[model samples]
Target: MSTGPNRIMDEFAKLMTDAAGAAQGVRKEMETAFHSQAERWLNSMDLVKREEFEAVREMAIKARDENDALLRRIEALEAKLAEKGA
Candidate 1:
């Protein structure tokens, strides 16, 4: 191969490599900025964390279960009272 063609090809390869490196750097910077902006936006809103939400959900479920049990117990007691009165 002629030196001229080889030199041109090497220069083209180096340019492509440099461009790829620059693109990667830009991509990383964009990702970091996007994440920062997203974090700021999220912080601006009032939101519950997953753990807190799950805790409240569990408390509600437990309260509902207890209420159901109490209701059933009352019904049973009422039935027993009627049987004795009759």
Candidate 2:
């Protein structure tokens, strides 16, 4: 009689363990599916990637800086020309 109860308890523990493992597997699959769906949705929105945006931003900054430098050079040349004319 004692052995019978012990055997039943052992079987129940195994079943619980298997159930826990199956639950974890399901959780992982759900996470993977969610991630894939999110990525697809984002891609469909025609969004620029971070790296590409950064590159374009840097180019704009460079062009602005170059324009400022050219403007300064032109002002200095105008000043020189006025001195020459006078």
What's the TM-score of each model vs. the native? Answer: 0.72, 0.75
Per-residue alpha-carbon lDDT of candidate 1 for residues 1-86, written as tens digits (9 for 90 to 100): 54798989998999999999999999999999999998888878977779999999999999999999999999999999999999
User: What's the residue-level lDDT of 68 in candidate 1?
Assistant: 100
Candidate 2 on 1-86: residue-level lDDT in tens? 44788989988999999999999999999999999999999999999899999999999999999999999999999999999999
Q: Which residue pairs of candidate 2 clash?
A: none
lDDT of 2: 0.97
- Top model number, TM-score: 2
Winning candidate number (lDDT)? 2
Compared with the true structure, all predictions reach lDDT values of 0.95, 0.97
